[model samples]
Target: MRNGGCCPKLDPLPGEEESAVRTSHWRKELERRRDSVERETDGSNMKTATRKKDGEKEVRAMAPLAPQLCSRLAQKAMMRSSVTKSMASRDRVRFNVGGQLFETTSTTLANAGRDSMLGALLDDSWNPGQPEYFLDRNPACFSVLLDLLRTGALHIPANVPQKLLYREALYYGLLDHVRNAKWGPFDGNRLRLADSVPGRAPGDGTAIRAAPDGGCCVAHGSVVHVYNWMLEERRPISLDYQQVNDVGYIDADSIVITARERLGRAEGGMAVFSAATGELQHRFRVEHGQQPKSFTAGALSLAGPDDNRIFSSCKGRLNEYGIGMWDLNTGQQGDFFYELPGCSLGDADILQWLPSKNCLMVATLFPRTDNCFIGLLDFRAKTIPWSWSDAGIVVTLEDKRVLHAIAMEDGHSICVINQYEDLGFIDLRAGTGTNSAGTGVRWSSRSKLMNRKVPFEESCYPKLATHNGQLFSCMNDSISVFSGSEHVLTSTLSRSYGGSICDFSIGGDRLFALHNEDNVFDVWETSPSPII
Candidate 1:
């Protein structure tokens, strides 16, 4: 044998023909062994090839992911989605909130919508390399928000402060979801009657008014009593020989009371009294003629730029009704008092007086009929600009139920409620055509109030009053408080009065409810929740 370069090259020695024969025999044996080895490793090689193909298939299958799929699942569960330990680090997210650690699917965080902080963080266009989020907020509160996002529901803890939770919700842009959670009826704990005062007379309270200076006036039987916010008696006027219809404040220190003499000379009149002292400041006698009238029809309202002029709806002659104006300072009557074209006022109630527009809202009921009329008396135009009767509104709706309406603070919209608990709005500004035939008034589609319970006939007649951009209505024993531009019920107060409410008034952030049975007056202070 001899070596040629690095490989060994066999050289035939002695006999060339014999060496060639031996080399051929060795080549044949080498081929046989090679074939045996290939056969032995066939199964192992096949498995290796199959595994490589499977790995490539998996990579192809996972190349694309749905943007919000992870979040949707977590939301449905009302909690964070759990990932396996074998999941890639990029698919999972860890959060450190106030020293608390939370593990969730990255897709779940992205489901908060692109506008939210979590969504922004998960957005690859903005946060390309983010793997974990650390929030400087209450972890417990964040958990609640997470559950809300996951479950489309909200569960607040007993120990948590709602204001603080609301703040967090706003910070995270979850206020809409949180506000929707509070959309149902109001809780009983929202509005609470804080004080009660027994009436001086044994008669039931007919009317109540909240004064400008945080005091209240109540008319029970033939007596009017004034009380401060603390329900302490300040003044009491015993009008045993008179029939009082309504009481209101002319100024912080003075109040105007409307009453009719019930004794020998049956005449209706308005008297001014000092709220500080129970002394009568002035008395303006009403002269409607002596015709032995069955019932009196008039409502007292103060107008003018300084709210010094008084406007009254009075029946001038038999079966004739008109609006009367009087100067409170000078006690002088206006030159002209306009009367509605063909309507007669039986029991007139002055709803509101807009000094800026110089308009007065009045609700009139016919003497012995189910007809109710609401009109706007524009002092600037010196006419009853617009009016609507129950019959006029009934033609517009399918359900012809008994309806009670109130003038909204906007001076254009009227809030109406019917016996069937249907709540709707009438647009006074949308009044079209001439006032000759009373053609124009638009009604909104009906909806229910905050009360989920079915309304009864007794509670159906909910009395509505507004204060500080909020509306208060006394329905049965509960007083509902609605506030905001949309007028959603923030809460309700349950009255402790033993009887049904005869009258209720909201003034100076105070709510007054009068019991129909024992003449007990319950007063509640408005504490509205913050708008979300």
Candidate 2:
């Protein structure tokens, strides 16, 4: 008898494809945007001649150009579908945001604190005109676009293979899109992120900076070793692999694995790997120490400007003191941004970073305090250079087994209000005090989407992973995957080859972990054993 086991992704029945088809709606808006830019630029050029008055200098607009041609060379922008007396009957583009409908030829969105890794997907296509143009796009996609527009380069997470993303960008000529804004897929009606992303070494390896998995620092006398519970079986087949002063966790196939120990340095520090198999990619340590005079550096941000990249306040006084920047492409330490005047050393954690405002939103609970303060740390100015403003409430992940990811503001903090846990969303944008929140995620539509709230603990084994559409989590030895009410689970190997299951971290659709008696790390797929 095949003993069944549960894992973290959805395995649709027999031959049924278990992946989520919930693609972000892109075509309709792309059509509207393309039409608008063309018309606006072309019309404006035409109007420039008409709008010019008697006294005004000849303010000639840019010369007109065709849509596809203009897109390739930037002669003009795509025309928007709009109207004048000649086109009064033309229908306008409609946008639905957070359930509100608006009649705007185009939409604009503010992506202050969205995930930058996701932003990287939008980076290839440049010169997209403006952020408002993609307003009707998915919030996550829009946020990334807004981030790139504001910061020039979008931040990629360390876990994603830079090569894979680069390949996707290169394939779609994302660079052209970024440069012209006119670059669309073959359809010519949608803003396309690449069609074929290179498969992950272990498939679907996204950034884990925000996974429920947190690093466990074990002190062997003076030296501190970083370890994570590999619930499944992973490489290096050890109870807990040592981080070796390596402040971040790269993807399963780390481009470079540096096992170096930098004493006290930030810029120009070198990292050395014993095995060179996949070793240290770059060099740069974060500044450490404390207030007053100055502080020496040590740690680095786990991910990047995005919340996934974070500061490892693991050193003395400065351990949790300042912020460190970890590059996703390369595991090198980029730069360090420390906190000032504020008491975030231990209590505060970066929930997310608002690239638009250059602000760091942290979730911290200070002493002499009953509530946790989700403060916004702005590093835009000089001098002490940091300001603190409170986000309505505090949130945290209570699971000891599962890894934790927290994003403060917009609506979520530690969780994305999905089928997994008591994760709730407070829509601050609605102006409703802190009380208004969304319950279980839109799991499926067959029923009410959400019926009753089970205790958060019961949601364990709650295989959690999100790709283009579905949100997944596991329960016990079973893996449950869901998208609205349309979801399923696959039970394969069940009977425990026992030992306290260390952990379960998912990337691409693969889960990595090490069990009790196994010295080898195991990789499990959402489906059976094949990569779809």
Task: Specify the highest-TM-score model's number.
Answer: 1
Candidate 2 residue lDDT tens string, 153-247? 44445554544444444333343223223121111112122211111122112122212232222112112222332221122211122233222
Please give the TM-score that candidate 2 achieves against the real structure: 0.35
Q: Tens-digit lDDT track for model 1 on 202-276?
A: 766778888765568988756788886445688687665577777888866888877764544545556788887
Q: After superposition, how far is residue 171 of candidate 1 from its true place, in Å?
A: 49
The C-alpha lDDT values of all candidates are 0.65, 0.34
List of clashing residue pairs for candidate 1: 71-108, 75-150, 191-493, 432-440
Candidate 1 — which residues are off by over 4 angstroms?
A: 1-191, 261-266, 285-297, 316-320, 366-368, 392-403, 433-460, 526-532
| Residue-level error in angstroms, candidate 2, position 371 | 6.5
My TM-score estimates for the predictions, one after another, are 0.55, 0.35
Off by over 4 Å in 2: 1-283, 288-314, 318-320, 326-335, 340-378, 381-403, 407-420, 428-465, 474-479, 485-502, 513-521, 526-532
Q: What is the lDDT of residue 52 in candidate 1?
A: 97
